[model samples]
Target chain A: MSRKYAAKGIFLLLLVNLLLCIFYVSAGAVNISPADMFHAFLGDGKAEYQNILVHVRLPRMAACVLTGSGLAVSGAVIQNVLQNPLAGPNIIGVNAGAGLAVVLCSALFPYCYAVVPFAAFAGAFGAMLFIYALARKTGASRMTLIMAGVCVNSLLNAMADAVHILWDDTLTSAYGFRLGGFSSVNGKVLLPAGILILLVTAAVFLLEKELEVLTLGETVASSVGLHTTFFQFLFLLLAAALAGASVSIAGLLGFVGLLAPHISRRIVGEECRFMLPFCALFGAFLVLLCDLLARTVWAPYEMPTGILLSFLGAPFFLHLLLGRSRRRRKKHD
Target chain B: MIRCENLSAGYGEGAVIHDISWEAAEGRLTAIVGPNGSGKSTLLKSVIGQTSVERGGVYLEGKPLKQWRHKEMAKQIAYLPQSRNDASLSVFRMVLHGRFPYLAFPRRYTQKDEETVIRELKRMGISELREKPVSELSGGEKQRAYLAMALVQGAPVLLLDEPTTYLDLSAQMELMELLRQLVAEGKTVVAVLHDLNHALQYADEMVLLENGGLKQCGTSKEILQSGVLEDVFRVRIHILQDQYGKEYYGFSSEKRMRNETGPAASGHPKRLQIRS
Candidate 1:
């Protein structure tokens, strides 16, 4: 049965995720041995190992998994709502909006780190509404939505750049945020981000059936008693919250949103019930793997995982575009 | 029964269907026939609240349509839009979506829901194709799958827009026969059709629309006898009776009488003709 296969696929993905998690946690800067990791788990490790495990590695790892899963799941939801394979938080201005808000918050408040995530969520939600309005005004075609998102992204990024120029003290952090990584993440950022992702992800799961009906197109969905506009708005808001939380933790991280959901779709077809969990695990594995490579590949001179992801994601994006066109041609034939 | 009281609806500024008052009788198959751009689909959409009704209202079972909640309305009336996209859903999953109005959120499909889907698929003669992806099915098979989805909704009133658009002749006849069977089972069936002969043969009542307004609404025999279709479609029609006394209709563009004499211009030159 398809259900059995889906269960097995989810299990395999979770297993892979666990393996990557261990690999990431053990091979970090301090290079904790497996024995030390076990000791730390048992609360019998040395002070140095315990400090590194609890204070440093755990938060960073949690940030990686949460950001990755949040972005990918948001991407899947946005893609279904918009009915565009290329739709993602990064491509649709959600991440850019959140990043811009964070930068502006840092510039304006200077010392209020607590306000950044809230501001990011507000900015992302505002950007989504603006894009939806523009799309509706222009008939809400797929191309118009993407174009509006691209324009909003450019405008918000330019504003963020202006803020950086205006506040010299925020410039260094803003630049680091722009080239996203987990270098500066701590429990302060991880806790709220994790909670937000968990809540929104649960909501998305509850909407799995609606999302499936939505994929058939708005008219069909509405005909089946679904309040299409209301559900679309709710799902978009959830997606924005997920993107905003991820951006709050890892600044402007791109491609995981676009890539992980796509890969999950290939593995699990388009059923959201299976695709959502698969996307979470695959996304976590991807980011954890990328983070591990970023740390180990250059050793002392580490690269940002976002940069590594873009390097891998651009070609994958093109492949999707080309494959879609080819399939369309085949359909016509 | 579904009734519209001077309903005017469209996408945006201008109304596509203007001030049309009509009713589809219960336990009968009604067909709406119109030429291209005559707003047949828009009229059906207005009934299901898919279009913006700029003026007037629609009623279902004596209650204003807007007063009914979405799930409640869906339980009363099932709608099948013109098949456009080739969705990648499996036939079984597609039919399962019809149970959406009945199932609460976050609840899995119950055994009863699955039984209904399977029964509908069997009725559609597509039980064997249940696990197949809908996108890979033939056009007739896909339409049947969509029909199965609509049937599983278990609504008393069914509205279908151009259900036979992409079907071949036999498939079209099969679907029409299936609709007639649904009507025989006491469900109200309404469809927008282009083929006048099929509408005449299968429908109990016919509603003709032209230029966004209702042109005629009567029994199929009455509409045929009135000969309003020729004027509405800008064509000449011939109603023929075979030896068995079965009535059929044929259509041709209005013939032109040529002033100049030529071998090709003898009598009335037949332009394009469609014979049923």
Candidate 2:
């Protein structure tokens, strides 16, 4: 039953994502016609059109898709592993952790771009480990883990702020960094991080059954022969890697992680096999549309994509919060 | 057979059950009964390696629990928790997870696995509810679905904790009958029962516990004859004969008394708290 729903949902999502991709590529700052866009995509258009398609538009589109899908899937995994609806990469400071490393590396190295992605990965992994260790030491519970994530998030954000203040002169993209945008994305960083995200996301898809079993709760998962603690850590590690890779490319894009998976859960149901792919496509589509709006809304005066995401995400968060409580009240009465 | 040797276990540093030793014999229904907070559930947890064992360990078929891989152990013993998630999954999919232990890498379900799930669902009389969400089922139907899931594990032994809690009388009796059927089919079954009458009437063997200690481990007849139920539970036990000379166990608790002269003394209807 889920399979049929997933198949049709995936088809529609793919079609929407494909249309959005074409619109995103064609309707940018230097608008290209459909015929010219097709010719340029095939690498034989007018020189200027081809150059814009290859250098500026294509890379930016890639950045949005990668950042969107990567963050969304990571959020889904974190939500499942932590067994909390509100938990996400951004909520738990994973993006902040990666952002801190990127800022510190850029500040210290100044010109060396190769080390930023690795530094981001290391930082994200470290923050996740710290939160888990704190929760474990305090006798881990669902509440304890979320509390630890809050503390770690605040601490990491504070450190990132300190770095920004200290290296105000050296870092040129400080403003753009806080308000994540694709205006200045480097293909050099995008390539490696994009590959990492794809590999990690594929790995998550392959292990969908294990993930589904984990959602049955710890006792049943163990009773069914899953190594609960090991699987939990493994998934958290994957989530960190994804958040790290995404932050490496697109600064600190929040809310896609939280919003995409949540909306996907409603559309595709909770089974990971269907939900994972649907989430990836839906997330890519969301970012594509949002980035398009960010670019074209105030043409010649681009808004940061993250600002648009926050506008959509913040209210959705409150709605979920209030709706959940209302449902609980109804259940009680 | 399942055995616990000098098992002392708890959640963390504090031991809830201490130095307890008992064995659930093969092809028999062993009911672990005690008052609340007497470590009845803790003992069940200890057997499944959910708790921290401070001193001893559990054994399955003469092998220490630590020696068996988790998947292998799952193939030998199935457990039904007292509380379970009402996951928003279809009943067919939920029951299919019973074949989880046998799945290999990538963990896709096989044709045989699906067949087994359908067979178990039909056997539990829940085939009509296959497409329904597990969370939407009634209490009795939900329990049946969970039981079908456990049975599909194909384990030789089964363990349950408070399987009848929150269940209506008919539902409780139905579940108990199902457990008896499983035991009669040559499966070892262990359950922690809150109702002593159910324990006394349904179980083949009884392990009476009090204050985290094993008061006695014997046949139901022997435990009833020993009179430990009255002492531990602080109740009066009565045996009545039916028309065909069949014995039925009844209980009267002083805890619910409302007057000085109880039902035994004044035959006051309101003062009587008889459970049979």
Candidate 3:
């Protein structure tokens, strides 16, 4: 394709993403009219109206979209870098590691709410460091990396459980986040988290091609001047950072990260550039729509969107795992 | 030109392909033949600066292999290593990976790269499978795709490790013919071949390596001779000429050496040589 055509395609995607953001703002529990939403959008001078529409709904919605996109993009990156279909958002236990750290820090240092995200960040980074060090010496091997990730995930979860056992009262928030629902986040927490996710995911877009090359096994990647080791560490760090941030704010919403990218891959083609952006949009939409369902389905009482997602995502995951293999054989021949 | 001087490689504390010195001239096909664990693959890997057990470096052009940037080396030497894991990529994308060395950040393929990938897909006879998932392809089809990726790298020096490892007779002939055509186009193609007859048909030259040592390096006609074959293989080989005047050789087992030595020493090798 020509450069002009590709640019136009990307511009169209951006336009659509923007439109979705607007729609997301317009839909919610408060039932704010689009005119008033737009008025609030334009900084209309009604404090109560602005608080209901802009302060409450818009930021949470933005958080859903950005986190959804961010986590999904990171999932796509992880899937390619590790070369495993099962390599979803928490494949490396980033969420668990972060959860463990947050729980430990929050429980042990009760006055450290701000440090929770940072603790999670440190925990996630530490877990990745351990996995990469153990599994990857010079080059990253797929099975070794996945095996290491699974081990770290189990170990960290155990530690998280240990922390919960010690501080049983604070365990509610910790466990809630671990299941990965988005209800707890307000505008105050969501805004900053959203910005961070957007920036990091943008960086992932930049590294798309490098990641694609890295997918073809490390030996080939190095032969082609991809700096396999450097890129390996770079991608893992970036994916973990974004995922850590997502976990800190939203807890452990499972399906958005894992399912979004796979669905987008089937839709937009396997090329990383095509897959990443669509995955991001779909991720956000899925979470927001699910959250909308959670709130309205049992009005005044909310089901965790994570629970709703798993209800839907489980079947899709099974189909992707089982059906793809058999269908692929017939199609290729 | 590619040169390996005093090259030694193996796992920690020991060496496999030891103190080997050889050169692959520009625009020539050189096949490496050796016993199992003889380190033909290691020797080829050292040339690309990939071997973890490198005691000494291989040089490309005039620079030490390690000194040259991997992308620079890739622009010169493309490699097709043995098949191990199946990638969950498309055939088109697999070939596109050959152009990876030329891509920078935001790494979209250029028109030129795309054209080469397309041309190579056709050349390797996998053009129809371009959109199909790579893992779903048959073994021969997979090997062909592997060859296409190497070809798409567009490097002057090519190294293939056992290009026909599991191929049937026709598929084996097909791959050999592809290599021959590559050499005819003035591209240097070095493939590790197990079948001596296949090597004899396609390889302009052969480097026989046995027990981590270079036994002989010369023209295929000279290296495929009964005396040289026996020296590297330590097996009785009877050469019979076909009606088409082609020399066909077979290995005959006579000496019972299994009880006389270590496991490594007594085993019959599958790959006479396996270059990277």
Candidate 4:
């Protein structure tokens, strides 16, 4: 895509994001007017309107943006770093890792809220490094990496299930966590994870050039004086941190990581400088859009954002798979 | 100058080239030539610290290869490997990555870096390709763009492995001429070549390898006169002169030698034949 066209698309996406933010705060179960919502934000509205907007919708909105941008940027980083378009936090067991950690932490800590993000980070980072190490050791191909992810993902999710089944009351709402709704998100949980996501995403942007060099592959990257191993590890660390922290707030959200970056790649070219920010914006937009649909589409009886995401994301994933296979078949032909 | 002393190196736990000592002088185009699997590529790779040196070490400007950090080494030596990734970056962005070692914190490309990239692109006749993705370029054009990238690195020593592999005959000639130009401009260039004729025609010095060991390292005339090329390759060479009276090397394979003999068997007119 040309720079001017890409710039236009980005501006449009940003505009949509802003409009969605306003609509998200306004069009909830009780339907606070835009005027009331703005007044609530400024500490002058009806007591009920102020309470719902301040306590519930605002934090949920923040969770949506944080989870969206975090997972999307993580997806972009994993795709580029691993040289696999199919790899995402959800696909590659990263969210499952965080999910398992969150479950375990809840089962163990019971009362502590601050420990979940760190626990999730550790879990996600471990899973990423394990998968990466396995790939390196086996000299894995594109398909093999996905296969490894599937294996790790299934095992971790099963372990989390075993934990949930063994201790019933350990989770306040196990289904909601699994399906990834922002309904349970509170300020205490969102604050630390939000700070983490913002800092890590900023760090990723700073390393955009280094990440670009890494896409040149190991030999060329090393030849050009890039510490390939170190950078690869570092990027994976950032990717894990983003995915884990997001999962801490929003339960195993499946496709934002996969869908957002791919969509951003289509709009802007894959230059990290452009792709990273675009992916973040598009990711935030997709989640906010899905969350809005989750709450308003059903009205009063809300569905989990994960269900809506899967509804939108699964078909896109299938299309990607079929398209890739068709292209491979054409090449073979 | 790159000097390897008693170097035995290879990938993990095995040495492909053993106990080899060679020197590539300043401002000379040295070609390493050998048959397939004879470790010519490995020898070139060792200079850039790509291989595990089992016994000895490579010295760049009298300092040990291990002593220089990656960025410091990159500023001194530009190495181009045999295979490259088809990156989806624009040609200008791809080449501007040559300035990676110089940039600090955020690694943003400066105006000087952009100017250097543009100059190298113009030098390579690919200024129009600056915005095009490298993956979309032709084989020869991609090679030139990569060469431009290496040039923008502004290193004194350039190492290339099979740079002419995927190029056409004309493109091969152009690349060889460019290497000569680089050498003439006082850059030390060492290339691994497969074509012995190109080695003989263009190289200031030739390092001949046979079965992962150095057979000879000398000027083209010395290597040609020494007969080691014929002995190791098991092919007869004809030092032919063109119509312009400039000399070039030609060879006949052993399979051809079995069925055909002399200059007539090679099937050319008398004007093309200068020696048997």
The numbered model that scores best in DockQ is 4
Better of 2 and 3 by lDDT: 2
- Write model 1 residue lDDT over A189-256, tens digit each, in one string: 67877899999999899889998888888888888899999999999899899999899999999889
DockQ, all candidates in order: 0.68, 0.66, 0.45, 0.77
How many clashing pairs per prediction, in order? 0, 0, 5, 0
What overall lDDT goes with each candidate model?
Answer: 0.86, 0.85, 0.75, 0.89
Off by over 4 Å in 3: A1-24, A43-46, A104-118, A137-151, A161-172, A186-191, A314-333, B11-13, B104-107, B238-276
Ranking by DockQ: 4, 1, 2, 3
> What are the per-residue Cα lDDT tens digits for candidate 2 across B1-276?
689999989989789998899989789999999988899999998888899999888998888888888888889988889888777678998888888999985568899999999998988889999988887898878888888888889999898888887678988998899899999899999999999888988999998888888889999888787767777887767776666666667676755542544643322112222334
Question: Can you write out model 2's per-residue Cα lDDT over A47-66, one digit (the tens) per residue?
Answer: 99999888999899999999
**Interface RMSD score of candidate 2:** 1.0
Candidate ranking under TM-score, highest first, comes to 4, 1, 2, 3
Better of 2 and 3 by DockQ: 2
Off by over 4 Å in 1: A328-333, B256-276
- CA-based DockQ, model 1: 0.68
- Writing each residue's lDDT as its tens digit, candidate 4 over A178-199 gives 9998888967779999999999
Model 4 global lDDT (CA atoms, 0 to 1): 0.89
lDDT of 3 by residue, B80-198 (tens): 88854577668888789889878865456889988999999988888999988787888888888888888898888899989897678887888788787888899998877776667
**Second chain TM-score, each model:** 0.90, 0.90, 0.86, 0.92
Candidate 4 chain A: worst-modelled 10 consecutive residues by lDDT: A167-176
